[model samples]
Target: MPSPRPDVHPPVVTGIGVASGLGHGKDAFRQGLFEGRSVFALLARPGRQRGDGSPPFFGVEMPDPPSILPPRVERTAGLSGRAAVAVLDEAWREAGLDRVAPERIGLIVGGTNLMAREQFLSLRDYAERLDFLPPRHGHVFLDTDICGLCASQFPIRGFAHTIGAASASGAAAIVAAAEAVSSGRVDACIALGALQDVSALDLQGFRALGALGAGPVCRPMDRGHDGFLYGEACAALVVTRPELAGGTIYGRVLGAGFCADGCRGPEPNSDGQVRAAQDALADAGLAAADIDYVNAHATGTPSGDDAELETLRRLNLGHARVNATKSIIGHGLSAAGAVEAAAVLIQMREGLLHPVLHLETPLDEGFGWVRGGMAEHRIRHALKFSFGFGGSNIALVFGAPEGAAA
Candidate 1:
């Protein structure tokens, strides 16, 4: 089948919803980014500790979103599902998507562990007490039920898919939604995803791998970089054809490229990243020189950031303004890409970019790092990178409103 021409049917983002450690909704998240303050506190309860007997690591856990789901079904939906419902309501409301028919709308959910939290909690509780307290009911304990539950609460009636591709899951979901809309499969589609605070399973796993940071703080790409802290966040985006757009477009998903690194271990090479960036440029019919800036997937890991920085140099994107936000907002696992992409769209819309947090020493001399404070620039076109653990790499190209300030 021949590829559809975007010129004839362009896909655009009409609305956004976010609930993260920074705060709830768009304004709160943007304000937190502007301040460049870290909201991380001592783990509310407790997690694994350093072998040296330091206090357990710090993390940020987002409070439950406004209660919008029916109590009966809410009990069975899991935290991920509940978060998705709240954000989808916000995005759907803002986009005026109610006018669209339920049958024409599509829903896609993404995350590293779509049902990890629910499954873990249930089994852990049972193991703690062999004597059963109460029996579980509905789909709350099942990951496969996420898609069906979301279909019932929201107007989405078309295809419902759950994508689990590690950290790039959310971005992968967005790429799929864009293709669905661009191909005329649906008038609009919502990409929803959420990650619970780092689970004991993940904490112990990353810690055993020596991936957690020693300092309470995390500095992405810093010379003293350690590792990432798990952050809780839920985000949703509404993508629809330009003709059906109800609100001003936040940005256009002009092009997307998805690839794999084939890395057997934690650290990966830069070749796959460079390839993904190249594919995005080609898909958008653009050149490396045409791009304005990049939102890097630097999650504060030394090896990962090193490889990503090398990829930027190889692509000759050192001149482009690049910002790493993981320092301000801890990595949200599969939700990182979607949330970070939202931040990029916000920066493009505002013409101001946030500075890297606590980055005193530089890791690479080639990067045009936005440090000290926010920087203002003419950003018409930008790039968003989503590189996940286990070698998944995705690149996305975003553009501001046409005929607007460059």
Candidate 2:
């Protein structure tokens, strides 16, 4: 950990919106998270079913997002696109961005190939009759389509684009959004983690890679941890300078760090993970001992969880309370980072840390672990870790709003 520069005034998180297996909206997510409720089940979607008569994969699927857009737009915007609008709308209204100059606002969407299931269904249904294929497929299939849809719905004219860093996409988007505001490029920016609509092919691919669990249950950090259960989720965070946000401020983005392992495989690299956390602590101008909590990037995979735990041990954050958000909601591949960031903010505001579900056996007992039920703990400074395949690792530091009591 290194000292932070005093002149750095990082962006603050003013509003957050989430849709997860817990339910839709911020309130639902907060309640369900702290209550330790889970909705995992055998995935029942049409395209999600295996064609070879194998057991269905286990996951948590969210209900279709509300039909809020115009009929024409709704027709073109598939489930993933609709989920993006639904989640971002809540954050936009909460951040009071409507009052800001349209040109001063920007948007960043996380994740690529976001509409796999939608494309899969369309191709399957129209394979014989290509003439009956929807005319809007051309516009909707591009990853940037989400960016276009969001920009059209909101008055974001400054700039808009997408970032795809595997599982770290959401964290990358947040870091980029924070920089955009800090550099005065935009007065406000929205970082959205779009839903990953995984098709049967996608699920099978993971299963083949030994990264997807075929479940009676999916547990992270436990000795029996096998693989990750795919969960459908979308989250958005509205970030701006403290002076620009007149509404309630959730927290501040103190600093962020990113690193690449140079390897192109799915294997976890402890050195890269450790460096990212250390860099984040240095950027925030705080020592490792200053951190009060950590939201770990534990995805239930044996190698992944082991690597993260080793990284934490090396960082010497034994004094900080630790928990895994994926334990309750399942894994939201691209959306995990933003959604877990939202979990961090909600816990900080409520002064209670959520419990890790089904963590019966301890992998290591040196760090403070929140288990069984919610623990009353006020977080002053927290760290969030998001690691993706291909060796992409990211770390973000968040702090309680200024003048708030600890």
Candidate 3:
């Protein structure tokens, strides 16, 4: 049957990689999530901690990166860039596209902090402490223009961009890449998103904006909710024309829908999220009841969690079990969508629904949150929602591999 949405087309996922607080690459991430692990811990920043009177910022601690890129490019980029390169390389190898012409490929990267955040923060910290000036570094700008930087690094010649629509950035990038492939503009594309290790500026910014919890914990959908715990990491996926790929099929990207609430600031609006989900359903040719699982964008902010729960309740996908990934790996800004999507694919492949960590108190009576261990279900269709600042909301629906029932 033809999908109802005009833009709907079958876009295949050829390769996937995730480097995040959960761990590097997809396998580790899947294991961590299945174990109901909490990757959150004390935010580690040496310069911030050493800086006079700077408060500590909690974040995911990434070990020193093993050599992946050559020495020339390795020294020129930040940790996020390194991670992006790693994932991109992995996807290329996985897809057996190492010999594909660069011009036939495209690159799209989603990020709120393109590498500049870390460099700027470190420069500021160094300047404050030693009154020293940073070197005239052209490489410092590499992370800022992830789209251009990645294209240049990988030598991609087609559509290249960095999307920054808050949390929706990653999902939006996926939509763009899928369109490029479906429209024949490119045979395949790579989408990557990364959030750097938390810095003093990042911590202070969220703190000043009153977005961080004073208790340093992110408890999504918990009755004792406070604010979010900021975390950092990166992820990338290789998307291609479905007919061209071979290997274990994780899931299919059925469709994507994006909407805006015209919101001016950092507050969650249930109406916008609900509309996004509705739009996605319309695109995927599925009813609300078709959704077997939902990976929610519950950020643990008192209002945000409430808003999402309210939205879900109103939408009423009664049979859909829900999991909130942020509770395990704190929100990774632009990286959130891809990470969540990766989590969903892993869950589907393993036939287990990851629990929404720390979601003890139900926001409502009817909504079901995946609590602990894996809930087994023959999930054929799933919805992943990502909402960002400015009321930008995006929803993506992934279905079972081809030949599977709806």
- Candidate topping lDDT: 2
What would the per-residue lDDT of candidate 1 be over residues 1-406, giving only the tens digit for each residue? 1123224345888888887888778888898887787877655533323335644766677776778888886665666777777777888888998899998999887764565545556566777775673554344544446677778877778888877768888888888888889889999998876554355666767777777775577888888988887777778888999889977688888888888879855765698888888888777767888888899988888888888988888888977998887778888887888888888888988889988888899898677898988888768889999987778888988878776654
Worst 10 residues of 1 by lDDT: 1-10
lDDT of 3 by residue, 91-198 (tens): 767776665677778888876655545666667677666546445254455545556546666767877777778877778778778778887889888777665545
Ranked by lDDT, the better of candidates 1 and 2 is 2
Q: What residue runs in model 1 are displaced by over 4 Å at the alpha carbon?
A: 1-8, 45-55, 128-138
Task: Give the alpha-carbon lDDT of every model.
Answer: 0.78, 0.89, 0.75
What's the lDDT for residue 88 in model 2?
92
Model 3, 289: alpha-carbon shift in Å? 0.9
Which residue pairs in candidate 2 have backbone atoms (N, alpha carbon, C) closer than 3 angstroms, thus clashing?
A: 4-285
Candidates 1 and 3 compared by TM-score, better number: 1
Candidate 1, position 74, lDDT = 69
Per model, how many backbone clashes are there? 0, 1, 3
lDDT of 3 at 78: 70
- The TM-score-based order of candidates, best leading, equals 2, 1, 3
Residue 358 Cα positional deviation in candidate 1, in Å, after optimal superposition: 1.2
Candidate of highest TM-score: 2
